[model samples]
Target: MSGLLHPFIQLGYGLEFKCEALIACALAQASTHRKQFSRALDTETFDEIRAGDLDGGNGLSLLDIMELMRIDPITDKITYDDDPYTEENRALSQTLAIKYAKLWSVGNSESSVREKSIEVMSVIALVYGSLTRPGYRPVLEFGVMHNLTSSYFLPILLDALPLHKKVRLLHAYAFTFIYIFATKGCPPLHIPPELTLADTHRAESAESSSSGNPWMEVIDKAIANNDMHVAKVVRALWRLSLLTAFPTQPNASKGYELPPYINCLYLARITVDSINMSTRRDSVTDKLQLTAQDGRRNWAHGMVAYDEFWAKYGQAL
Candidate 1:
């Protein structure tokens, strides 16, 4: 649950490949994360709250929960320091994250587990792909992007765990997602209708050939690029695109609707476009020159100012 999800991701790969060594490494990594997270996980304080919350049946979906948090006065109270590792900042943020995250329930049944996992995957994609400042060039925020990439492993990890462990893992994952979102200043989400409708529009067009599929170009660039993050994000979004295609109906019983903005294929295209804008091919080597600093420089970090984000675009809205 810590280390920006690297430990869990490693464990996912280990399980997928049936490799003992990688699993061992993941366990070792988990042992080194901040003690506060471990303590929070061990505490039973939320058990009663969770039970009472679940008694009313299904709670709000992750997307709805995020919206509540976004507008809540508490969101304004979450402040970040230049050094994110400051103990005071982390303590305050994690406390709030757990408080709000408990609002969502990971059900005990197998079908519930599967449904909850998909719900999470969709919401994270919405956050990662849609939370951009209008009129400015798209910049995938560094921290928020991890929530999407880390989610790619949820299905893999959940499949191997027992029902109880699966529920616990989802809780931890939710906590992490909320904490990161708060730290990123709870940026306002805006789903561009054009981006979400890209797939539908393409299918109806005359030029709907294999060569015309935008994903083909996105994939080519992703594979050609040397950055591992680009490849991971592309693969994750592609997997999500496939998963989202068939589940057209919102789960009324579970109280979750597939938000209109979640078109994973187009989200993948947006990510690739953003990366292309931030990088240039070296003339001599004919390869992209992407450095850690270059990646950080082009992305928005910390809180997003509401006034600035809406300054130029508010009139149309």
Candidate 2:
């Protein structure tokens, strides 16, 4: 992983490296990347990577690799979704975990910021490249899960993106990777309750009934606990995934403003200068309730912005 990202980072695709690598890896597979990688990880071969068919190549999910290495157990609480991870791939995952762990540490460290950042991107490439094979893991790991987008990693990533004109491309590319990984991959072929940004709107729904707007609360207790099966998650993901590569900003003049979040869904993963708005303190429970008189407000419209965004960019990559 130390030198894996070197090719992409040098090409100024740091932020976009994962996306680019995802495409490259997918093309290498069967001319498609993991159905666009969860639209998760795509690789050198397609038939060998799908679940339940480990015949042609090595079939190891990231969890299997990590469990084989005995790493990330504390931070990543996940189960083996496939067959028992045998001793065959044990050595491979261990070697990967070593490089994976190094990248994780360097990514968070403040020392040698620039070099460390390059190494981080390289590791992403290296790891993803490795997974392009049959025996490799298929999704992001504990430190790499896109769902952690809302957590401390965002700030760390923000810090890594130096505020320099010459290096702005790095920020963009880095963000591109962050955007998809966060929104798309939760668990392999599954979107956990937390991964769906739609639920973030739902989390704030109950509170919207009162004076406080739906956008006020970012993560609602209810939404976090809400669980849907993989089938529904996959369908929603497909509709949303194929609709747009990048998430869009709202046209609304005002709405509740939750804690600030970076929008790297579209913007070529260039800069944090995308857009930051102060949403008005209002919410509509449904499309019909978009603008009610006294207490007919709803948060469905809050969710509409995203739905419409995918529709708007429906034909894009």
Listed per model in order, the count of residue pairs whose N, CA or C atoms clash below 3 Å is 0, 27
Model 1 score (lDDT): 0.67
lDDT of 2 by residue, 242-290 (tens): 2222344221123312112211121111101111122234445433212
Per-residue error (Å), model 2, residue 295: 28
Superposed Cα deviation of residue 22, candidate 1 (Å): 1.3
Candidate 2 lDDT (Cα, 0 to 1): 0.26
Error of 2 at 80 (Å): 12
Q: Which residue window of length 10 is worst by lDDT in model 1?
A: 308-317
Clashing pairs in 1: none
- Model 2 scores worst on lDDT over the 10 consecutive residues at 266-275
Candidate 1 lDDT, 1-317, residue by residue in tens: 35648887888889879999999999998887766575456658556335523463566677777777777776676554444436665666666677777777777777777777777777787778776666655657667777778888888888888988887777778778887876656677877775566355232123556755767788887776555667678877876776666645246464565566467677776766556324557899999875443242243454453554335323331
lDDT against the true structure, each candidate: 0.67, 0.26
